[model samples]
Target: MRHRLVTRGAVALCILVAVALIGYGLAQAMTTSHQQTVQGTSENSPHSGDGTKANPRRTRLEVGLDGCTKGWDDPGAGAQVFDIKNTSDRPMDVVLLGTGDKAADPHHDPRKAQIYAELEALGPGVTRSMTTSIEAGHFHFSCMPEDGPVVDGTDTNVPQPSAELASSLPSPVQHAAPATEQELIPYTQQYEEWVKGQLPDIASQADQLKDVIQRRGPNWREEAQSIWLTAHHRYMTLGGAYGAFGDLGDSIDGTAAGLPQGPNDPDFTGFHRIERGLWANESPDDLLPLAQGLSNDLSSLQDQDLAVGALEIGLRTHEVSEDIATQTLSGVDDFGSHSGVDSARAQTEATQKLVEILRPLLADRMPADHLTAIDQRLDAAQKRLDDASAAHPQTAPADLPVPERNAVRSQIGQLSEQLAEVAAVTDIRRAT
Candidate 1:
């Protein structure tokens, strides 16, 4: 009886262990199956319903442009991908802007609303995509007026879309908003008139330079150089009106980069040309034509119906410092004269003037303390230039020793950072 009882107990223990092992294997299999299902869904399935796929929701808008067509008749607000085609002969750039509050908030642009995205320099017959997220609101599309002449064997003109279709296009603001919210058209007109008033001073300076160049006396070069500096500063003062100048601006102050051969290129016209001639010790006669060309360009610009709209006026304030960093401090602008600091001084002073003009408008948006600090920074930068100038008489900033040059560069860099904030604060962007 004892042996039988032991045998039964062993069998029962074996049976119990077998059942436990079976249950554990079943559980493991079930878990593996579940994990496989999840992995399959994530890796194999298209448009996984759980919102795990990359760019799960993408909206596409087909855009077609030519000389005649302007914008999409129907625009939807959301995250959108714009596939734009340039059907025109010339290269094109496109901008889509929201009608957000056009106030002086760095985080916001009231008139332009908000910038969705921009596609720039699209070549003829080429297609490109621009993706941006936008809020539900009014929006408009603009193509930068094409640059240069139309390419041969390509259509320069396209039939205008039907009037019904044209009417569907969103209406752009006829004029830029004022610094104050008082009047839009009047404010823009007033600014335009002001731009007109300033042109004469530039012309007069150019005329003085022409006279100095014509004299060719014993000190003619010195007199002409000094007058050229004055004229250059005066022209820079018109930074507020840069946009309105358009091609004329290029004819007046365009750099050599645009030309194939750079500085030595025959196409290299404007103030810098004279600068090269003067600094290279070229004869006054050799430089006279360049000087005369500059004077003539100024006079022509004076007569042109140029205007500094509200958009450009605000932009000039920030671009001045930006130019300092990219051009002046980099010593690109002073390749001929080596007076990069002088150029910087003139640019900064003019930019300061622009800031002061816009201060009242800016005051409403920016903290007074921040504005004061910017002023102080500008002053400090100017003082550094002054000190360096005093220390190194008859020496260009480019010729300064490395240490002294670095010290000046550091101050200018600091000021540039602060100046950058002004654009952000104002929410200014160039018109496409």
Candidate 2:
């Protein structure tokens, strides 16, 4: 009996040893599999924990303003983004700089840093963003508050750009040769003749409107107003010619805001005067002479050989868009008529015409992407204007729904930003 019990005990020990060996084997396999998985994950990761990568792209760089915080991360060039926030109670102008050795001293100031991008004139609590490509370099940020000390951050002494960053920088844009006098004269003359052709139609419509005002029939007032709006649209299309039009341009389209006498000023003439009269329900009898005078002025405009400066005309592609945003989109251009949307459309059409005329010159000169972006934004802005007009057929532009108004404002802002680059693309210049 003792011998049998001893043998059973040995068997039990063997079974126990077998169980321990199996468990150890399973654990070892699991550990090996886990280690393989971890190694694979590390190798496949796009960016390593050390911040090195192939074509490292960063999220938008946040800029804090209003004496709160001033800081930025070096995005290491390629296309970068900036989200500028104004936390203060006043306006702030934030600038993004790519500094060189010259910027180490504060006394050198603005000249030391090359301003790669800027968000100028942000109202209190406003936030705006800009997307631009930069060459890899030492970079920092500066914010100038309207009512506080300039807040600056990030180490000013940035290290030398990496070789990868330097390689990613875009080649310098090759500018188009400036249009010579011989080339400019014909284009300018053709554009001027185009302006002259539109004036006769403007004068003719003004005459018809004047006649309707004189008739004073029940429907004559409406007919007259319709003619006036039509005439106003035609005149707006000629905005590129305004620089050459001189004082006559003001007499024909000037607003009352800056004038000492205001809208009631006798000098506040042309389309706006007629608009005030029509909207205010002023006596049709009183508006007759104003319409006749507008017609006469328009007729005179056709006879004049208005010589425009080449640079002035070249700059109009950008300047027209700027004016539309500042004046028409703001609803100041047609305060009485509430036809600001129509005015914007007119300006856009004129600018597009100018684009077509200069397309050959612009082909390889400007960045194709910029031109394409301008077209897309302009189309979006036009759609927004159309939507506004359709949604509120009778509502004045100033009184449109906040959403619609915001849409218009946002689209116009983007469109203007793209348009602003046109002058530089065409090698356009200010007068010498």
TM-score (all chains, Cα) for each model: 0.56, 0.59
Model 2 spans with C-alpha error above 4 angstroms = 1-183, 428-432
Clashing pairs in 1: 100-113, 101-110, 102-110, 102-111
* lDDT (Cα atoms) of all candidates against the true structure: 0.55, 0.58
Q: Per-residue CA lDDT of candidate 2, range 304-359, in tens?
A: 77876665555566667667766777776564678887777777777777776666
lDDT for each residue of candidate 1 in 340-417, tens digit (9 for 90 to 100):
666677677767776776676656545567678889988988888777767875466768889988988888766766
Candidate closest to the true structure, highest TM-score: 2
Best candidate according to lDDT: 2
lDDT score for residue 285 of model 1: 76
Worst 10 residues of 1 by lDDT: 24-33
TM-score quality measure for candidate 1: 0.56
